[model samples]
Target: MALCEIVNKIAACGLDCSRCADYENGEIKKLSRRLQGLLKGYERLALIKAKTNPAFEGFKDFQELLNIFAGASCGGCSSQNVKCPIDCHAKTCHKEKKVDFCFQCDEYPCERQFEGKMRERWMERNNRMREIGVERYYEEQSKMPRY
Candidate 1:
């Protein structure tokens, strides 16, 4: 509710805003709440999974990682650390070479060392936006004024 300065149409994650649930609250809020509950449920499952599944043992430290994402209310990239990937090869390489997104630089798809997880997420968001229509979703979300 604090009229935070949203990017209006773009996320540093390369998302075209209108796709965000926070940006389209009416229809989105229910889903968002559901997702919030799901995330919480996922955390619980992760805890259980961490104990039994060696594959998920990496998630043993899930709490710490989720804490970073918990406060992120789609508050923009620069402002939200949740969007900032930890040890992101893309960001590191970008900084080392002095560039922005990989798409902007010479390397659109660096198979040698690419962020597959992040890339997949980007694709998912993009596809969802395309399906929902950016402005349609935005108008719905805009109803819930930030302040």
Candidate 2:
């Protein structure tokens, strides 16, 4: 695909879908599967450990993490399955305003639902998108390290 096309995969929330761990690839799914297998294998051991140790209580946290990994796959907001509040709001707002991005709206910096550092990050990203344009923004995002 063309660079611009790839960049256009960025979500309305300013997240580069292309940089998402779950975007197009099955890394998260594979990891989740492996973790599930390991957890299954260690279930008995975990049960024993939990009986004598408080730290093993963290097994619940591990299961939560596993759930996150398992649900990490996404195809961006355009996907029919996407149901994020930010994505839905952005899409609706942009469509109503006939603009391509949130930055184009007069309420660009207005508080919709975001708060604190999250709002700051969103503003910064939207400003950067405006400053650099979508294509270049994606290129810059591509150069940044991924989690």
Candidate 3:
């Protein structure tokens, strides 16, 4: 099949879909390891640098980094951005009100929680929206076919 055709068939998270491990799972592990090493070294450096570097000043408490890393790495909204009904609902609702993901709406589904496969995607995008914002959500989501 052609590239576009293949890509179209391949599932994606639309918003944070690029965050998935996918074929990059191995790379994620390697990069995680490297980041851990650099972070460890940075931690050691941060101790001394915090007295000088403004950047380190904010991160003076190494416990904060450890606390942040204690949780899971965000994957993506593969279903929220790709699944059938959820994708349809998101697009239709957005177009109806002329906004991006539910985040922009005054009446967002704040009740959403990690439940079904589709919920999993929302969990990721809900978090990603904080980083990328609603415009990117609509932009990426719009590229997707309605069906």
Model number with the top lDDT: 2
TM-score of predicted model 2? 0.62
Which ranges of candidate 3 are over 4 A from the true structure? 1-16, 20-32, 60-147
Reference-based TM-score of each model:
0.29, 0.62, 0.32
lDDT of 2 at 21: 54
Q: Tell me which of candidates 1 and 3 scores higher on TM-score.
A: 3
lDDT of 2: 0.67
Candidate 1 ranges with C-alpha deviation above 4 Å: 1-87, 112-147
Q: Over the stretch 1-147, how does candidate 3's per-residue lDDT look in tens digits? A: 343432232332233233333322224435555666667656667768877777776664544554443432433232233323233355345555655445556655544333677667665665556467544554565466432
Among the numbered candidates, top TM-score falls to 2
Q: What is the lDDT of residue 47 in candidate 3?
A: 62
What are the Cα lDDT values of the candidates? 0.46, 0.67, 0.46
* lDDT (tens digit, per residue) of candidate 1 on 3-113: 123333444234433344443322344554555566675756776886878767665365444443343355333232224333445534645555433444465455544
After superposing candidate 2, which stretches have Cα over 4 Å from the reference? 1-8, 17-30, 72-74, 85-88, 96-100, 104-119, 142-147
> Once model 1 is optimally superposed onto the true structure by TM-score, how far is the C-alpha of residue 19 displaced, in angstroms?
10
- After TM-score superposition, the amount by which residue 58's alpha carbon in candidate 2 deviates from its true location, in angstroms, is 3.7
